[model samples]
Target: MKLSAHVEKVPLIHPFHITGYTFTHNDLLVVKLQDGTHVGVGEALGVYYKHDTPYTMLEQVEALRPTLEHGITRKELLELLPPGGARHAIDAALWDLEAKQRDMPVWQLAGMEPPRPLLTTFTLGADEPEVMATEARGFEGVRAIKLKLTDDALNAERVRAVRAACPDAWMMIDANQGFTRETLASVLPAFVEARVAVVEQPFPVGKEDWLDGLDCPIPIALDESIQDHRDLGLAVGRAQVINIKLDKCGGLTEALILAHKAQEMGFKLMVGNMGGSSWSMAPGFVIGSLCTVVDLDGPIYLSADRTPAVSYHDGHIWCPETVWGGPVAA
Candidate 1:
């Protein structure tokens, strides 16, 4: 096997803002693993909060070229890398490679039923009340919208405006750890009134216990707080849903492990994206079959997507077998 990696810059259609960072482009790391007969490709946007840059991911993967060329199994690869983008890219490529090498789909290997088209949530970055409302209204045929929120007075106004704009759409908010105990409490009334389905990472990581005081009605979701299976213990009473991002949890290898454990503990599952082209979103698309909420809208935010890419229609995302995991599209 041969290991190769490079950086691919994907411009975002609009500025993407969360708690403390804004993205205008995705500097992704694309990795390829090959055995003379076939080649497999994978991509990762890297985790922004943890500073997992493309170059860093590249260096991390490159350092293991010797061992990778010697051919490493997915489970062994897990111990060689921590849960992040470097591992995510390689892990995904391996899945793709194995799927073709064995003439099987990644989902079948993962013990999942045939993949189905999934309803995905189109996300809107943080903006003014009216601006966000306009953005939400602009999404034709997209019935689920995930609103990016911040720690401020306007968070409530933002949700209220969007809810009014798309009254019948399913609404969810991801604070990206922007709220404090007080701020989350302050926004609870408007969130409830707006019929917001869930509030994600309302309080920053390590403050999972903040929900102890407020009898909040909207269910909370844990994103940044739970990176992998090891962190599942932190979500017991803090959140009702766990947003699994391949970039954060490494890739499908760890994601499947995390999802199973999260489900067994009674937490609803959500598969999300860090930000990349269809190559990155495809793996999560497979995970979507087992998830209650799917947020693989990364390609929707990009200026352009790869060929044979995943498609968005009506209110769902469809990935063909030629796009990603098992023969490409998982």
Candidate 2:
């Protein structure tokens, strides 16, 4: 086996702004593994909030190259690194490589059902109420829209605008840890009025206890608060959904475990991304099959994607047959 890695800066169709940061481009670390004539690829976007960058991921991958080249099993790989972008890249590549080696898809290898087209939520980044409404109006055939919000005075106004623009679409909100207890309390009425189905990470991580006994109109999802299985207890009664991102919890390997545990605990599942191109979204598409709400729109935000990209239609994304982990003819 051989190991190599490189970086690619993927430009976004529009500027993406969350709580404290804005992104015009995503710097991704792409890893490749080769064994004779067969090759597998994976991508990781080590975003700043996660305390990781493309450079750090590349360094981590290079440091593990010796053990990887010499040969390492997937089980061993998990123990070799902690959960994060670097592990996600290597783990995804291993899954791809193993699937190709067996002449089967990664889904089959993982005992998962075949992939199907899923309705993905298009994102409306934080902006003026009118601008967000205009953006919402611009999208056609969208079934769900995820609205990014801040603790600003216009939070309710933004949701109202989007809901007015896309009256028929399901609305979700993500505060990205931008809200406080008081702010969230003040916004609950508006969320109920706007018919927002889900609200993600309204308050910062440590402040999750603020929701311990409070009645929330919509299902509150924990993103930053839940990293892996260990954080499951933190959201037991506080949040109704857990947003699983491969980059945050390592990769598909750990994500599957987290998903199962989340289900066992009676928590709804949501698979999301940190934002990247198609390569970064491929593994997430598989995870989406096991989720209730799918948000694999990372590639949709990119200006360009790899050839033979994941297909999108009527707000639903179809996993490309040519990409990693396929339902190839048996």
TM-score of each: 0.97, 0.97
| Model 2 whole-model lDDT (C-alpha atoms) | 0.88
**Runs of candidate 1 exceeding 4 Å displacement:** 328-330
Q: Clashing residue pairs in candidate 1, if any?
A: 106-326, 324-328, 324-329, 325-328
Worst 10 residues of 1 by lDDT: 321-330
Q: Candidate 1 lDDT, tens digit per residue, 1-330?
A: 988899988899888888888899999899999998778888998888898888999999999999999999999999999999999999999999998888888899899999999999999999899999998888879799999998777988899899999999998999888888778878888998889998888888888888775588888889999999999998887789999999999999999999999999999999999889999998999899999999988998899999889999988999987897755333
Estimate the Cα RMSD of every predicted model relative to the unseen true structure.
1.6, 1.4
lDDT minimum window of 10 residues, candidate 2: 321-330
Score candidate 2 by TM-score against the native.
0.97
lDDT for every model?
0.90, 0.88
Over 48-68, each residue of candidate 2 has an lDDT whose tens digit, in order, gives: 677888889899999999999
